[model samples]
Target: MRTTVPPQEKLSLNVLPSEVWRWSAASIAQQIRLGSISCVEVLQAFHRRIDVVNPRLNAIVHEDREQSIGAARQLDGLHRQDSHARGILRGVPVTIKLNVDMAGEATTNGVPAYSRRVAPADSAVVTNLRCAEAVINGRTNVPPFSFRWFTEGPLYGRTLNPWSADITSGGSSGGASVSVATGMCAIAHGTDIAGSIRYPAYVNGVVGLRTTSGRIPAYHPTTAQRFYGLQSMSAQGPLARSVEDARLGLLAMLGADTRDSTWVNAILEHEDDAEPVRVALVDEIPNVVVSDEIKKALQQAAASLVEAGYVVERAQPPAIDQCVEIWQSIAMTESRFGMIAAVEETGDASIMRSVHNMAACAPSVDLGGYIKAIALRDELRRKWNEFLRAYPILLMPTSCHMPQPWGADLGTVDEMRELVAIQSPLIAVAALGLPGIHVPTGMSNGLPVGVQLVAESFRELRLLCTASVIEREAEAGSALNYTAS
Candidate 1:
């Protein structure tokens, strides 16, 4: 709860505007490098903003003000010496999700019992961020074990949505999105297995990227066990107010890491610059009921893409519902092996209820069924790969509707199933390990709504480019600039 601004030794006496906190990560780093702004000034501005905004939102659960200031001072020293800092994110203020390891901090994952589980070394993502000289401002919150669509834990309490307190902030990356939305940080590290990053960004009126599996290496040294479903579905990404910043973060976090054997060094951009990007606009899906606001947002995004010269067609990807089913089957099936037992031992009442309800929704299968599910998952990935080959980008609703009220998923087992059904677009694409971006369109009835732009693995550059155009349209329509404090 230390909210005091950093000592203003190298800072300007004139009060900076509230909008200073909203500068994109790229712009912040550029100014810092150009000697126009000191890293200390940028970090202090964010810490001041965090004090003003995070108290109400509870988006940042943990902070190390001294550590952040020291890091910024070091970057300033490098600048004084006429030596550049690290990579593209040098001197940029950023937040890390609490589930990941940052040296000397606990990887709490919102569990009270493991509050003492301090990490001895940085996780792969943290290592990458440090290498890029991205100053860590604070650690964001998550649900216990990150096991729900809403972010509230017995240890950390709840992360309120900046837009509406009644609605969900969207877990397990809820705090990350809220932090970005409120300008707590320029970039937020987020990981998504099923809609964790995208859903929160959708509700918070920000941008979040769920990169393809293995695009960003992730490893928690304290909890480093191999989980099949997690290995296949989970991806490390970034949440920001702009898609360009998200793209910058994704690039900085990429490349192979020995810690994660699955990490790939594949080229991230389009192979052929002259190739035309084909976008599939999916406004409706069979058996999915989307709100009119959601439909309008999708149509608006489609029109934006069309204007941007992307060949937009009204079409749906193959087996949308089947992909969701596979996600539930594999994710729940793999969790049963060990995660369920851990939750039973240490989870709070809310998380325990959610785990049970989610378990009830996707019953555990025998070995034969598990094997078939894996094989079926492979088949679905093949089909999606083929489909994506035809349509390089798919523009669809991020969620079937706006974010639900807090604790909606904790209702009856049937209610949990309904919630999952609505999140089919998020879960399905995750099942196939594709990269998806949540691009916010505008507000609806004081709530945020947006569309999802998905691309084949390693085609994140294309998705970001398409989202930039949609972002331009959204900015033109909305009176309140999201980046403005």
Candidate 2:
């Protein structure tokens, strides 16, 4: 419901910070509703922090402060009108990824090519956040087309990790992760094609969740047909400093968003929470090399879960080695048919770079192999389902290494190819269409590393529930460059 409130007017108030920037969305909302803090007050505090730290972080780029304050004021007015029940999100300021549409704002996806193009309507994800009563305060930075784990595009420049400017803030959700890590937003909206959300959260020392393919509806009016694997491999999700915040954000985002036709009504559940469920920890996923430091971080995380009364086992799943091939075919076909065509049509260098990568992979893939790859996808999903039936959560390295330097991983097409190769596990796992969480556990060479947790379809509650166990026990965080005041 639109309100008649003016953008300039606000309920003047101030609230002191309860503690560090580690506040969760649930806790912040509770505090706002309890009148311990006003919506405007909390919103302003975050804004101030962003202004102070974002120069170095470059997490949040474009934002509508007036609109946000106005929304907060409207919520305040509503709360006064009816204090019986607070809204879904009473007073939480959030950052939206630039790749997604927001009404009357440009959805650039960090392309220099479309920097001036503005979206005519809000995306399903954005609409859902508004419905949940979250204040849309800022638009985060994303790589060109939300493609890579390092956040940099000719349009919005670069989004450096708050942990260290030297290392990358994982993309395409890299900006969102940086925003949350630096306290710019309580929760950030992000999308994943391969390891976009998970990578950023892994690098920024935060938590990121990738909803199942249908679990969160993704739509863009620009294209009539979405590439097959790009259609199934991609998802929109939340990035936060804590698992509880991830839970709250995912709950608000899950549902049938009419914008996407494939969305299903898959409700979340917690199966037999009375008895602790099994968790599988995998440090090896075939091709990727898990660094010794990264291995230590995963082991430490596993030990913490064991201490928390959950049965933690060191094991690899059935057919994990074949995942990369299947994933490569699925991803390559989407690019070969879609992205390659777009690049050839435009002949733009940036788009051409994307095409070149696809063309390089095309020759290696067989026509029949692609078809069989599609068939095998079903079997892979089945294996994950059966595995989750026994072990509700699977823990593994979010990536094999700590956050890479901002431009270290993607300078050349070869380098970009290498990144995809290294992160094959994440891409393959995401294709199964299950909910997964990437929780920052430790750092190496002063950069953050994380452990990933995967759960059954629409079973975000279980993923978050299991994640909470490791989050508290392993108090590890990403590398942060704390400036002296």
Candidate 3:
């Protein structure tokens, strides 16, 4: 229920740095509830930050400046009425990905033809954020249909990396990652079907959580049909500067909604007192090529986990290669029917070229082949499940190599295939509908590199707890403070 606002007008306040835009969502909410700072002041700080840095990055494309001010004022009024009333994300500025629905806003998904396709109602995640009193300052950009690993489109233009303009900002949630990394917002809402959230978080040097399927209620009112892999494999999650902030955002987003019956009512954390679980570290993925820097990143993360009291074993997850193939088959088959057709009808040359090349990597499956793939998928999920029962968490590289240069994905079919191979760590977890966390360890060759932590479904708490240990040891802010040349 919406809290009643006080009769008092919006309070006049002065913005303060070091405690304003730089604070995490958890800290912002706590400070606002404690009356240490007015909600208006916090909002103004982010508004000023966005004004200064957004033009250079182009991360946040659609902003309702007046609406945001009004919302912040409303939140301040509510706080005045009941200082005790504090949602987990109260007054925290958040940037929503353009692909998700926000009432009366365009769910463009980077297609110019559908720019007028305004959402009549908020998606489940948006409603949850509003209920948690998050101020929606702006919307982040995405690739056409959010399909590419590089964030650029004909509609909103390309989102440049804060570290290097030559490299990608990482899509389809590239804009979301950049927003958090550059202090555009405390937390950014993003989706991950096949590494969209984690990859961007890796490249952008932030913490991203790819919650298990159904962990967060998600539904786009503008979407016409329900595809096979969309709900089962994809998830709405948060990308933030720190693991604690991401955890808070995930807490705010967890719940069941009638609109998305597929959502599970799972507890965020178990009450049992268990020791830190064993971790499987995979530095060298079989048959996939990776740079020495990537290998060092894996070792660094594993070493941190060991120091934090986790039993770090050097082992690979089962069926890594097969799971990647399953992702290709499922995505390719589903795309042929819906996503591919729509892209062909409305997509620009860049997206069309990337999509076509991706298709070349995986042939369209027939009905029988599709059924077999589903059966194979269940078997693979079973393997991971049983394996996870033994090793509760698996730590691996987010990508085999560093972030690709701009327009790398829009290359020859062979190049796309190589890209897919390097991304097996992300693709495999996606296919099994598991939870993965992308935590940046350090940088290599002037770019960020990180590790992916995977856990069983409904075990996000386990992943976060372990990631926090590594985050603290790694001193997470070095990359965030790096100034691009």
Which window of ten consecutive residues has the lowest lDDT sum in model 2?
1-10
Query: How many steric overlaps are in each model, in order?
Result: 0, 3, 0
Candidate 2 residue lDDT tens string, 1-485 = 22111112222224433542445677668766777667888888888877778887788889888989999999888878876434566688889988888887877777655666777787787788888888888999987667666777667677776666677777778888888877888889988877888988887788899988878877755435576666777788998777767877876676567778777777565445324578888888675688787788778878888887888888787676576667667776667665556445544455456446634643356678777888898888888788888887788877776667655552576776666656766776777766778977765666666788887787776677667777777766533334423
TM-score against native, each model: 0.93, 0.89, 0.94
lDDT per residue, candidate 3, 367-409, as tens digits?
8988898889999999899999888889888888899899888
Q: Which of the two, 1 or 3, has more TM-score?
A: 3
What TM-score does structure 3 among the candidates reach? Answer: 0.94
Two-way TM-score contest, 1 vs 2, winner = 1
RMSD of each: 5.5, 5.6, 4.8
Best by lDDT: 3
Query: Which segments of candidate 2 are over 4 A away from where they belong?
Result: 1-22, 341-355, 358-363, 366-368, 411-418, 478-481
Off by over 4 Å in 1: 1-19, 83-85, 271-276, 476-485
Question: What tens-digit string does per-residue lDDT give for candidate 1 at 396-436?
Answer: 98899778998888889998888888888999989989899
Q: Among all windows of ten consecutive residues in candidate 1, which has the lowest summed lDDT? A: 1-10
